[model samples]
Target: MPRLLSLALPALLAALLAGCSGLPSRSTKAEKSVYQGESFAAEETFSRLFDANVEDTCEAARRALLSQGYVISKAESGVVRGAKHFQPAGEVHVEIAFNIVCVGDGPKQQIATAYVSAQQDRYALKKSNQAASLGVSALGSISVPLSSSDDSLVKVASETIPAGEFYDRFFTLMQRMLRENTASR
Candidate 1:
């Protein structure tokens, strides 16, 4: 009987495998197109060409972020990173982080381009209920009816700011700062 059962199991497994072969398979071609950036154009929304050098461009980017209440976390000759926090509701918080890179783009390193990207992170307050328990000599264990909860801010979502107007405004500010710095020197 055991040998008969093993033979039947192998036959059943083969039949199930044969059935799955006829089913349609999912196409990954559609998913690949979602990540394709073939339609990108040089709109200059997230970047700006400057007549100054890379160092000057980076400095301007640092000032631009500082003027808007963003704390500069890292600053270098060609890179800058800053972040700003906001509280839109009692239980919701948001933070916008800015990353800037400046590189020479023209002849003799006289001209540079500054590229900027900003990502927004959202956080929501979460509350969790906890139960209290007590152990006594007479009773094995007793659960108290006291209600206790823990509240914490948890990150909900994060995404890069995709609006053209948002990046355009930031580039405009950087341009203004660059002009001011040139005038001061």
Candidate 2:
């Protein structure tokens, strides 16, 4: 009986320790603000600037812009060419650019630019394999993370803009968009 009791005591002690360790760690709460009235169309317009497939960054920018009461007049993609490079037997390197423009009531124009370039490989076999793999996995995954980071910008705009103003309304709409879109996920 004593031997059985000893074994059970150790198990009970281990369980207690494990339970204590599972408690949530300390985390700081983000400050929240309110916006009275804003338009949803502006937010949608900002979101449309990015690839429709990558909702997170677009949502972030959308939420930020809308919350500030900025109307989006234009959202389009354009290409810019950079210096060309040549490697090995006969291959050329090029750089492509993705541009976004969001206009509002005032002088400030919300613009975002993305530049992409192809990687150079010394060996033909390595370059071809890497390019294929990147096309399949890396390309699609890139935009998702970029969108997620837009939340920080939204937070900043929310805090900076005063309440009941045009910018305030825009930011408010942006916040609402983020909440609605993120909830669906």
* Top-lDDT structure, candidate number: 1
Strongest candidate by TM-score: 1
Candidate 1 stretches with Cα past 4 Å from truth are 1-33, 36-38, 139-143
lDDT of 1 by residue, 1-185 (tens): 99999999999999999999877778633456544854566663677788899999999899999999999999987999999999999999999999999999866999999888899999999999988666675776676677699999999999888748898888888889999999997
- Listed in order, each prediction's TM-score against the native is 0.77, 0.19
Score candidate 1 by lDDT. Answer: 0.89
lDDT (Cα, tens digit) per residue for candidate 2, span 1-185 = 99999999999999999998877655643543344334444332322222222334344444454444434443333322222223334432222122223222223323322222212223222121111222336455533222111111111111222223443444345446656776787
- lDDT for 143 in candidate 2 is 30
Candidate 1 weakest ten by summed lDDT: 28-37
Question: What TM-score does structure 2 among the candidates reach?
Answer: 0.19
Residue 88 accuracy (lDDT) in model 1: 98
TM-score of model 1 vs. true structure? 0.77
